[model samples]
Target: MAASKTKKQVRKSQFKLTSEQEADLRKVFDIFSKGGEESGYGTISAEDIKIAFRALGYEPKQEEIRQLISGVDKDGKGLLDFNDYLAIMTKKMTQKDDVEDLQKAFELLDRDRDGKINSGDLQSVAAELGYFTGTMAEDLQEMIDFADKDGDGVVSEREFLKFLKKTTFE
Candidate 1:
């Protein structure tokens, strides 16, 4: 009788990494993997995970690393395989990029570096963009009103972020 062969199932990740990103991740993983250059499939210890995170520009607390490992380490081994490391790193990198982009936008809108977005800031930005007109005060006030959730007459960083999240996500 002929033996039936079963194919290994490959799980698809929701997040996709580019070739350069994948290469960088592999380099980091191999550097810390238990097998080093030999097996290329070994897991890394918790301490190794912390070092790897730093090498990748993350400064997570030890407790945060432990929690992340616990969440992603599928075999309950308290170690990270390449797949787990990739997932965690991908998520962290994406989150950091999002926050950085948001911060840049907020700084541009803040104009005077006062940590808040008021009508003056809006007017300055509008004028820079050639959108300012003689009657733009009412329009700018409307914009501020839309974003000022706490009725504070201005948008703080937290409020601006909340407004963006609401508009973008919903």
Candidate 2:
């Protein structure tokens, strides 16, 4: 007997949003799209995402949310999104979490595949985020060092997962 594989049908794009959902999502976008409103980085903050999800009656894991937000990392620069807020939020289902999403985001951030986010990439991402300062490079490098437990000068999957877990939905 021969086996047949079923191809999944793909859905095209649409831009229809209920007025209330649109308003709430937009509010969230504005909050995140702003640079360093709280932290010195323009990157989307955890607080911003929590508010957004709360508006939608949802409480997603922050790391999961970051993976979802990664979809808005459109320029392949490993930076967070600022312009595609509404489109990304509306397309949330495609950004849902899984082990694969975790791996992908990590890979994207780790430009050299040395198992960690390098200071150069981090600084570039932060600058694109409109939040970079000379000292931020040192601070982020320290975070990398703190997170990279093996002293291999790179963050292994285990280390990354530990950090990810800290951001997960309880």
Best by TM-score: 1
User: What is the per-residue lDDT of model 1 for residues 1-170, given as tens digits with 9 covering 90 to 100?
Assistant: 12332211111233468999899989989988886458677877877888898898889888887777778987787777788888778867765665677778999999889999999999998899999997999989999999998998999999988788566533
CA RMSD per model (angstroms): 8.9, 19.4
Lowest-sum lDDT 10-residue window in model 2: 3-12
Segments in model 1 whose C-alpha atoms lie over 4 Å from true places = 1-15, 62-67, 126-170
Candidate 1, which ten residues in sequence have the lowest lDDT sum? Answer: 4-13
Best by lDDT: 1
Regions of model 2 farther than 4 Å from truth: 1-96, 167-170
Q: Give the per-residue lDDT digits (tens) of candidate 2, residues 81-134.
A: 444556556655333333446778778777666766767767777887899998
